[model samples]
Target: MAAEMTVSELVRRARDGQARALGRLISLVEDGSPRLAEVAAELAPHTGGAQVVGLTGPPGVGKSTSTSALVKALRASGRRVGVLAVDPSSPFSGGALLGDRVRMQEHATDDGVFIRSMATRGHLGGLAWSTPQALRVLDAAGFDIVLIETVGVGQSEVDVVSLADTTLVLLAPGMGDGIQAAKAGILEVADVFVVNKADREGADQTVRELKYMISLGRREKGPSWRTPIVRTVAARSEGVDELVQAVTDHRDWLIEHGELDARRVQRAENEIQAVVAARLRAEMGELRGGATLAGLAREIVDGRSDPYRAAEQLLADLRS
Candidate 1:
């Protein structure tokens, strides 16, 4: 067992590159301890320094490849990068392949790059339950850029927008139907759009279709904030510099318009809500006694009482 460390000591050790301390701090957050709020308050001053970029798209759209290429480009410009690749968990084994980390081999040994793979564990949002804390760990550790990749199962992964300063939605050449299906959610959240595997046939058509969709939406425009679609063949590192420029341009626009600070404030509020909801659920579970609650759930399922009434009774018991 690791020695018990106070929140301040843990924060100091984590800043000093103590992996054990960092891991413990993340665990505290994951478990929804009140200490997490304390830690977040202490670390808020250190967080806005990092630019968080979220990447999400359908499976097999070359998201990991694109992420690796972007990280390589950013590193070449002398920036420290942190990657959090969120992989879907296997139902039977509860483990993830983390194929993204394997594809990012170029940075495997670089100390300036820290890559971690997280299993979603059925979290409703694309982010893992541990994500906010993981981000805090990276922020405290002093990474200038943080990239988050999510397994895109297509049902509103817009939660990424709440966690990241900018979100890049990746689409491949043959994903026109998928894009059409996800347009409302994807287009609403993405600060920029990336068409990977652009060397493939039909890539231009996809870009045109997306542009048309964006034009149909009614919104106040300021300084040409139209979401620009950049094409890239990430496998070969083609067009990466242009994509980087697009990302930088978007960040610059946000900062100039003062939206960056507004977005960060919104993100902090979302994180607080997520943390509180998780803690309330966990405490409720403990109060009910896990197995006993499971038994009550079975009773409700068997028609003993309506779920709402049962839940109310359980809440009364918890309070008593």
Candidate 2:
């Protein structure tokens, strides 16, 4: 804990390329400290520049491997990279279970790469509760690219798409993931389909199935930027450059079509809503001392008021 540094100092040092300062800032957000507003103020002007890319898929799809491969490619091109690997929280401890730094030890010594594994902490959709704020930290730190890898919690993990400019849905061969991916509603959100472990026997089948499935649907995006499927054996770092190139192409497309700003605006909107919701929850807890929501629940339970009416009364009270 960098407890000695004030919020302003942390923001200044982080923007100056101090990794420790940036790490502390992210921790502050994860812990939901009151100083978060100050941190946000410091970061607001510097954000929305980093290209956020989201990678998600079923378990065993090699999302971490692909992320590491992409980091290598990005670093080789002199781009500073930030990787956020969201891992499941331990039930008792609330700590990240799978330490992503271990898998990405290859970049451990690279000053150009910063990787952090965040605990999902019972948050659903395979994202950390503090992911948006943590991303703002990385963006304000002047990273050229940010790679977000989800907790691999199956289909409901599309929340990453809201925050990323380009979302990669990865599938491994022979896992029945192709059908599951479609069932998970992942087919619609993927800007890029990554077939990992491409050297495996079912790789061609996976790619073919995805292409066929993609052909059956029409994108609402105007001007026709067809999503590309990139094949990679991430363990060997093969096809990573092509994947990176595909991401670059998508970023360029977003910029040209003015979708980048649109996405960022949506991202900020989501963040603000989350903040307001959390604050309301805190306020509701305080109101518990006065039997507000509890009183409403009792009224509903005793048949004195319907749930909808009780909810309306609670909203009226909150506004008052």
Using TM-score as the measure, the top candidate is 2
* lDDT per residue as tens, model 1, 1-320: 45466788888877776656766776566555667678777676766678889888777889888988998999999898888776554534544444543654666567678777666544323253578678877887788888988766544355654578888888889865745646545556677888899999989888887788788875343456878889899999998999899889989998999888988887778877876676567666776468656777888889997788878867786668
Question: Which ranges of candidate 1 are over 4 A from the true structure?
Answer: 1-10, 16-42, 89-105, 121-128, 154-156, 176-185, 218-224, 288-299, 302-304
How much does candidate 2 score in TM-score? 0.91
Q: How well is each residue in 149-181 modelled by candidate 2, as lDDT tens digits?
A: 885454335665568899898888997856666
List the global CA lDDT of all models: 0.74, 0.81
- Tell how far residue 245 is off in model 1, in angstroms: 1.2
Using lDDT, give the best candidate's number: 2
Alpha-carbon lDDT of model 1: 0.74
Give candidate 1's error at residue 16 in angstroms: 4.2
What clash pairs does model 2 have?
none
Which lDDT value does model 2 have at 188? 75
